[model samples]
Target: MLIALISLFLAGSSGGSAAGSLTAAGVLALVVVFSAAATLAVSFLLSKTLLRGESSAFTLELPPYRVPRIGQVIVRSVLDRTLHVLGRAAAVAAPWGLAVYALANISAGGETLLSWFCSWLDPAARLIGLDGVILAAFVLGLPANELVIPIMLMAYTAGGCLTEISSYAALSEVLSGNGWTAMTAVSVVLFTLMHSPCSTTLLTIKKETGSIGWTAAAAVIPTAAGIGLLAVLNCIFG
Candidate 1:
């Protein structure tokens, strides 16, 4: 949900379907297809090579086919997964959110901490068709995947805290005001897809693997892939 929403928002912000403007659906489609294919390829490669194991023979038992139970599915989705993930996410998001809010709001030398940090990151971020603000949002929003877009909006609008624009037009205006282009939209969508797991997922990975090194690798791998791909694409087309 977070990824889809952020992709859509960036697409629209790049002047999607506006008067005499091209929509970013083309770029979004490309990113989605490529990201999905890359993920599949990596998984296959890992299973076949680094993580290979001898095949085991086993007998399987089958249950009699029955009609699907809608209520049971709903209960399982809510109780078994949704709430559990949400609880963990909330635990990380709360304090992190407060820190983000404070950083964005507190002025330092006539600029907020976030603004200063973004300025410093601008040169590198531009290589990938994104600005420092977007990169900073991803970093600060690490506590929860869902916070990326909101934090971006807050940064772009210079708001004291995260704020949602009432309409797409307003969002487009703010983004355009910050020099957003179709290429920027494409890069953002790709990066969002490739970026590291949110804090909750990182915690889960650590718990499951019991290795900080592996957890760190899991985070770095996708981000590096995203950065390299974005740089190539931006050079070719931006």
Candidate 2:
């Protein structure tokens, strides 16, 4: 239930979508309706199919809704811990995000290096509907996937002038001006799905694996897959 709710909220928050313009309260209301419908369907299935025990066996306890004895304290505890962990992660990712902004914005030799890289990569990059520097920005964004689109947008826009993005429509216009098409959209969606988790996720991976080998592979394997898929698509469409 929790995961489903969070996923729906994130999907709703995707700024590129016209549907994302829906109010948060409106989205939550939809979520509640969906949840109730799903619950009813599951209950009916269990009663008609699973309860017979011909193919499978299971037991479910639907407890009556009731306030817990320590509901107030429990709610406070959950909120505090959730904020603490997420707050620490925000602190860790903040400077890295800022540094990314600088790298995308900074110019060398009176021209942004990112633009030059994109031009160089254009020969092959165009096949995948993206430029090289945009690809590189996405790679760097592995440390924090949340920033991928923003960095790529910045790299593509400002011609490396590094403008502050205050609106999604502005970002959309910039990409449209830069020759973006449907193919580019497909490649980016794939890349985002397969790229390494952000810096916080990397930290979690390291802690879980307790070995540099696994941690590195966690990053490399997915990246390899994404790039390989892009290359294959390029060859077919190039």
Using TM-score as the measure, which candidate wins? 1
Worst 10 residues of 1 by lDDT: 14-23
Clash pairs for candidate 1: none
Give residue 69's error in model 1 in angstroms.
Answer: 12
Tens-place lDDT digits, model 1, residues 136-213: 988998986667778888888788978777666676678778887757766777788898999988988998889999
TM-scores of the candidates in the order shown: 0.76, 0.58
Clashing pairs in 2: 143-198, 143-199, 158-161
RMSD of 2: 10.6
* Predicted structure with the largest lDDT when compared to the true one: 1
As a whole number from 0 to 100, the lDDT of residue 121 in candidate 2 is 70
Candidate 2 ranges beyond 4 A from true positions: 1-84, 113-129, 159-171
Report the C-alpha lDDT of model 2 over 1-238, residue by residue, as the tens digit: 2222222333344633555544444545664675467447655755686355555556899999887669787787778867756765787667766766566567787666566565667676665656776676666565555556566666766444334566545655776676655466556655655556676666677777798876787677666656777778867874
